[model samples]
Target chain A: SSHATGYNSNRILAPYSVYKGKAAFSLTPSLPTFTKLHSGAVVVDRRGSIMVIFMHAIGDRKYDWENRQRFALSATEVGSLLTMGPQDSCEFFHDPSIKSSNAGQVRKSLSIKPHANSNGYFMNLTVVNNLLNTKEFFSVPVTAAEFAVMKTACSFALPHIMGWDKMTHQQSTGGTVGLQS
Target chain B: SSHATGYNSNRILAPYSVYKGKAAFSLTPSLPTFTKLHSGAVVVDRRGSIMVIFMHAIGDRKYDWENRQRFALSATEVGSLLTMGPQDSCEFFHDPSIKSSNAGQVRKSLSIKPHANSNGYFMNLTVVNNLLNTKEFFSVPVTAAEFAVMKTACSFALPHIMGWDKMTHQQSTGGTVGLQS
Candidate 1:
């Protein structure tokens, strides 16, 4: 029954975009939000733009809703991360479209680096808003397990976004998205 | 010199716990924060706590600072997830210490479930604060690659947290932390 799928069953029935192939794995990292939980996904949209989508829930328990926001990264942007070193922090979202305006938001910078605290080392995400002035939003944490998934997802999604059609089942020499041999 | 390690070199030098067997992999997921980039780590601390630590940067980037936070889960908590299905939302952080108080914060429920949007399917993280009145905070998304790493990290970190000593290099029958053979 559709009811077995929980709170999101209704949304699945909606006119959401149909994705081909299968998204094999994903993880929801724990965040330090005082109120709600945060989630995300990576998909190659119909336009073939590799998008990292995030869902932020707002309002009170009485009336709750989500603000679905995302940023598209080019194939080059996603590919660069494949070679990212421990000491390196790569800024990928330089697209001016990010500044299309979410409350005077000029630039949103997303960088992935290894971070540590008194507890231990972590995979750190540093996202900052370079508006007229820089204001920080939130910093979330993911487990080492989750980080591996992210890297693999990028590798899997890369071939899709780079115009490698899998449905016809023909391999494209130009669309190999993996560790270079 | 340690200066080559970037902003976290100082933390690495501090008396923070020394982790053996090398964490090998970690990732910082892209978060939808108005201000800061959030990062996380997976480690078996000195006390053997399988901690998922997160750093949330606050204040201004000029006088910027971070609030280092984390939650520890038992081997059982980590193991239960190995079998989690698409429809399951497993609540892992039932630890009462989470209520130790960061401004009247009570039960913080951390759940992992698959979520979807007009974009595509996402590995959803639903972290809700069950305080006096329910307040929704942030729902962050992770790519499929990142999520796969999370699961593998759990498989890796679980043995360490479950009293599987590696320095001496002897396998234990009770310390298996992977899929059932």
Candidate 2:
């Protein structure tokens, strides 16, 4: 079926993917005076492959919610596989839109322990490391130089000038008001 | 200011960005019979530095909208830079969500002539070539192997598996009914 070959087939695990890994960092508050929710997981395949890791944070206001999803990879695994070179490092952030004043607020957070069980599967650092070290036919070696070029090109291609950092101050802090003609 | 250093600054030139290049390819219908709206632009700085290019597509239904924003770099520039090696080539598709049956329908498309005007800045083959070949302090050489690894890693990091390809057929085809629950 298409799932076997599709690059995005791994998304099938989204609903249950939340249970796969332990929290990589402590949850910290960013914007004060607002309710904040933080949740994250390191998803792995049935055979213990570390498919993805993501952290999401949301700041809740009376009328709107501010959210951010930070996605990343383990540097150790990436460095070993790609020979990323000493000078190479990478970081990515995507801020798509500004929340309108009338948008409703919803908050949900998941607490996953180091050995949480999901569908009878469990994951730990050893399992993740084993998966990373495994030699797969699909594994390819990438150089640091190539990564640098692509990064530069993408930066130039997607300029995030939406003033996301200043969003918290600009959002309406008062109760919602009905629209006036 | 951070805005000056930040890679993405709204570019305020979304309207003008379109004139910076030619249509890389014809806009062919992908999901037939459904209303399709496609918009694209190649954003550049006031000094004419190519910053980014983006295209958005939406398939409308009676109650909800199925939308996608596909971000890409110029193939001509990328292909020439890496030589792509023997095993390297890239294709991107974004399937965000399925359309609900009751979503409303709307369609619009933009026409970009080869030498359209944008704030008196017109881009053609020569302009693009000049931008790519310029000796910028930020320019870096990237290899094909590195690009492949980064691509594979990103796919696993962000999985958009909502069956957007099957959205056209599944959304509410009949009249909308009030929520029964």
Candidate 3:
């Protein structure tokens, strides 16, 4: 295929230029660069974006840290996590009939419960792939103190992005969420 | 508190009875009973509802099957699982500001990937409870043949409840999803 010259590529650009035949240079600003507020498998960045990491395991070999997986969460999702209960679980699924195989038949679920020794909690991850007959499993643990810190950091993080003033106020005052009835 | 007599319980029902003081009798039907299509950890029932079970473990003691947990899924959720890809993940979270603590601060996620040696796939489940500082993790595996059967059964199950004729037709003919672009 022959390449079209700038003049012939888009004849519509033939007018409104400072030069006779040159198109005006329009500079596109680069995307924003995010600074790290914290860095790890699970931490909230300065931009309030969160990253959660988990690992995969086979039948008897449960330690598969080499195959670490990371997922990002939005501000609202963080807020939801900060308020969820131990037994409550949520499901997310996409319409599988779409053309994109990657998005098809996808279902992801999450639930959390206490660590038996009362030391910490484990985050449960369940992944299923019907097309390939595959399922990946992971259990990531965070200590109780770590969870408290994460919750505090997350509350601050979301108000930075979502401007939930009431939430921030409640946290600052060390009061229960007044938004709840 | 004084108990109201049948005649006084509902003054609005004082009229249109077989007798002046007697109200017409009506029977309330019992709710439908569900028969088990298949029993055990994970199976679809005759009612088209699906049951998924996962066990919890504490620290190094991974075989905690005695504390097995069960979750029910609607027909549509089963269909979504049948078409999901190995890498795709979905999230479900509820609003935290709700008055009900049980329904608050909940986040659940599910994803899937292939098991080692191609024996099967592992379903990854992640559940978080920000309020209790707890999380639960579980990874369930299903062999390739089992997955295929589940997919077929799920495809049939949804159409039974959802009346998705196109989906059932495509599955019956062993045809690629005609609904896909």
Docking class of 1: incorrect
Q: What local lDDT score does residue B25 receive in model 1, on the 0 to 100 scale?
A: 15
Model 2: per-residue lDDT, tens digit, A1-181?
A: 5323322232111111221122222111111111123433211111111123332222231211132222222223323323333333332222112274422222112211111221111111211112234311111122222333323322221111111222333234334533244
Better of 1 and 3 by lDDT: 3
Model 1 lDDT, full chain set? 0.38
DockQ of each: 0.02, 0.03, 0.01
Q: Write the per-residue lDDT of candidate 1 for residues B77-173, one digit (tens) a residue.
A: 5655543444544565443444465543544445555655422113222234455465433233444455565666655554344332221111111
Top lDDT: which candidate number? 3
Q: How big is the positional error of residue A7 in model 1, measured in Å on the Cα after superposition?
A: 22
Docking quality level of the chain pair in candidate 2: incorrect
- Interface RMSD (Å) of candidate 2: 15.7
Deviation of model 3 at A64, angstroms: 53
lDDT accuracy of residue A164 in candidate 3: 41
Model 2 vs. true fold: TM: 0.20
